[model samples]
Target: MEVLSLKVNGDTRCLAAAPQATLLEVLREELGLTGCKQGCDKGDCGACTVLLDGQPVLACLTLAALVQGREITTIEGLAPAHRRRCAESPCASKQDKLHPVQDAFDEAGALQCGFCQSGMILSATALLQRDDDPKRETIREALSGNLCRCTGYTQIIEAVERASDEHAGREHRPRAWEQPATEPAGEGES
Candidate 1:
């Protein structure tokens, strides 16, 4: 076992792991950060997604040894990071403690089984960090690597949009289903 120094969230963690141990194993087993799920154990599924230096990566496919001295952000770190940021602002409320993307996911009903939540949320967070107002297609492209069997991608997209809108201080828009249906044009109308 080799000792690795990893900076996760905002704290530095030192642990011993095998040279071939994946980041998922070390984060979950050694550091007790189970937010990074072990889904496919391969790169096909994004269930093990984690932010490596503000970018989403497949933790199950990343070598723990290779990630030494890099910034790793797990789902568990989202809220704390947000809280630290919120300390400077007046938006730190008890009910609003979760990261905007996380809260938006919950509010938008973007999670079902929750197996893909961590990855989805992390991906969305990364996207929003770069693009504050991403279009639907952009959002879809950004999250293409992460797959969700439950939400059908609609709510997930909406959650990302909602988070962006909120971050931009835009007025909240009703969901597609919540919007009133338009009347069909009458025969007399051209």
Candidate 2:
């Protein structure tokens, strides 16, 4: 067994894995991150997609040992929730606070069986990181590798577009704590 050290989801992780084991195996089996699915095992299906150093990569084909010093981000990493309760937070309900791509997927009804949702979301995330306002064709090209047997790609594309719109909107919108200040009550009545 080879001990590999890598950063995963902002945490340093060390696990004993076979030298030839795929990153998918290490992530799912050792790290207990099952979001990256095992579909084709040949890197063609894209269901095993993850962000390696902020770029989309097929975990199934990436050797765990080869990525020892790189950052690996699984689907779980993309949708982290703060420890605080929704009632105590000013952010929207927990669901809306999920990664924008995930929120877009949910809002657009882009997911059905959910087998490919993780990969699709990650792919969308990577693409958006590069282009905050990608055209439909760009969204299609970004997600071309991920195959969803149910949604037929229309909803997926729509989801990415929606996420892009939201991203743009967020850039213009103030933070939850930055709502426009209201004038003091009856201040002008003096």
Q: Best lDDT goes to which candidate?
A: 1
lDDT of each residue in 116-182, candidate 1, tens digit only: 9999999999999999988777898999998887746888889999999999999867444344458
Clashes of each: 0, 0
* RMSD (CA, angstroms), candidate 1: 7.4
Candidate 1, superposed: residue stretches over 4 Å from native: 81-93, 174-190
Show the lowest summed lDDT stretch of 10 residues, model 2. Answer: 171-180
What's model 1's lDDT at 110? 90
lDDT, candidate 1, equals 0.89
Off by over 4 Å in 2: 80-92, 95-97, 170-190
The local lDDT score (0 to 100) that residue 81 gets in candidate 1 is 64
lDDT of 2 by residue, 1-190 (tens): 9888978987889989988899999999999999889999997889999999999999999999999888889988886645323425775676645787888888888988999999999999999999998876778789989989785587788788788889888532211223457888767755
Model 1: lDDT of residue 63:
96
Reference-based lDDT, residue 98, model 1: 82
